[model samples]
Target: MNEVGVIDWGIVGAGHIAHRFAQGLAHVRDARLARVWSRRTESVAAFVQRHGGEGCGSFDDLLASDIDAVYIATLNDSHAGYARAALAAGKHVLCEKPATLNAGELRAVLETARVSRRLFMEAMKPPFFPLYRTLCEHLRRDPIGPVGLVRAGCSVANVPAEHPSFSLDTGGGALLDIGVYEMFLAVDWLGAPLDVQTFGRIGASGVDTFASVHSRHEAGIAQLFCGLDLDGKGDALLAGPHGYVWIHEKWWNPVRATVSYAGGRVVELNVPFEGGGLNYETAHFCELIRAGELESPIMTHEKSLRMISMLDAARSALGLVFPGE
Candidate 1:
């Protein structure tokens, strides 16, 4: 907390996604950008200039500051290390998705947060979206009549070979990058799976270029597809005996949705939001911090752990392993 009763945030990693998160800070009234750190001084300087924050000489300097929370947006492999350091420094953490490379790493960081008594949450923006909230409410009312299947995909074409997204050492793969969103939707809708099966096309770099996962849950089934080497329709569909709901393209950051019943009636919803859609999560984080909460109700630590565990299983089935793992 700051002098003005707002949460002061220190951002780690000044990448493109980090800049978008800074843009989201503009839409949050209870949070202020306070400090930023990155391995490259030039990137940190640019981020500070564009986002109105002080540039830290190193990540240690940022953690040593009086910031209320640290937002980890670095490469997937470094999430646990930075989050552990921040928690040890008595700062809350909002790390980007795939909180760590595997469930084991996630457990370690979460244990540290428990001991430090600091709030820590994975930065999953969609769960806080108004569109998703409305969808959840409708589902709770049983309008869909027991959802039996969920199909989701997020795929992009032709990522350059040199991109970090294709490096095994960096924890690069379709599963960690975009597949996590699909997994989140599945788990949020159907709970953890009883069984998970996965198949993938591994690249020369040992990272997956394309992947498909199927999970069986008590409620029904979830099928997710993600790829860095192909284009996809980019939508998610939940279906039941009586009706179905369709989240629009880019389902992860959906702006529109439709619900259709067996009786030929359909309802469409358009969700309007501000500033890159990350503002929703930023605002929610501030609310939880102010309320003395350790995790988000919408995206709880348990949910994150389950998601990572599923990912770990999927990786094992697909025979995909990071360099150090």
Candidate 2:
């Protein structure tokens, strides 16, 4: 940040999520894409050409360059490594969800961020979306009582075989890739996961193709499911003693919600998003960087740890361990 207080960002992995990050970056004030790097040279070149960033020759170049932060948008397997390297290099890091392969791995990366004394936040975008924020405010003002249960799920069966979600080596599966979102909702509304029970099937690719998770949190219980071989509905529910909140289908990219109370009173919330849904999280990260915050108050490190821990337990129950685990 120079006199004008602008932040430059270097990105790892010019993949699908990275493209969304770049698109969202356009909506973040005073943040610019400084450098882009990925495994494939051609992908790097193409991404840079489309997204208005200089293509870096290698990851070392991207880190060594004079950038204020790093966004780890790589696959699940590499999120921890890139986040650790970025924080160790004295850059604030905003890594994609799951943060790492498992709770143990996330702990190591978080320790690195702590020693580095830099901001590190998992890119959990739902809380920042307008609809979600509105829901929080409404709950605070009107009261939803103590939320005691959370239920959510998302699954798609048409994913191509070549997609990384089916690849066991890259740490792809419905749990880490999709279930993490549901877990985040549970942890946010309920609390730290105390116990997790799961039932699932591992596909021929040696990865979990579908999973159903039932978890006990400090404050409540959660029922979540994720799959790459089923097309289940993708809505979410939060039940309380006095009422309930319903985040409509595709809740992860939430736009609408309804609150129903014990008195038969009802309220509907609809808040649209722009510049893609990822911008909200990107903007929040930028604000945290400026404020010298190490952990996000909303997307706290504790919440991330709890979410991934639930996934770890679920994976363990399913006997779906990635290589080198």
How high is the CA lDDT of each candidate model? 0.90, 0.93
TM-score of every model? 0.97, 0.99
Q: What is the lDDT for 269 in model 1?
A: 81
What local lDDT does model 2 show for residue 203?
Answer: 97
Regions more than 4 Å wrong, model 2: none
What's the CA RMSD of model 1 in angstroms? 1.1
Q: Give the lDDT of residue 297 in candidate 2.
A: 98
True-vs-predicted CA distance for residue 244, candidate 2, Å: 0.8
lDDT of model 2 at residue 219? 97
Give the alpha carbon lDDT tens digit for every residue of 112-178 in model 2: 9999999999999999999999999999999889999999999998999999999899999999999
Q: How does model 2 score by TM-score?
A: 0.99
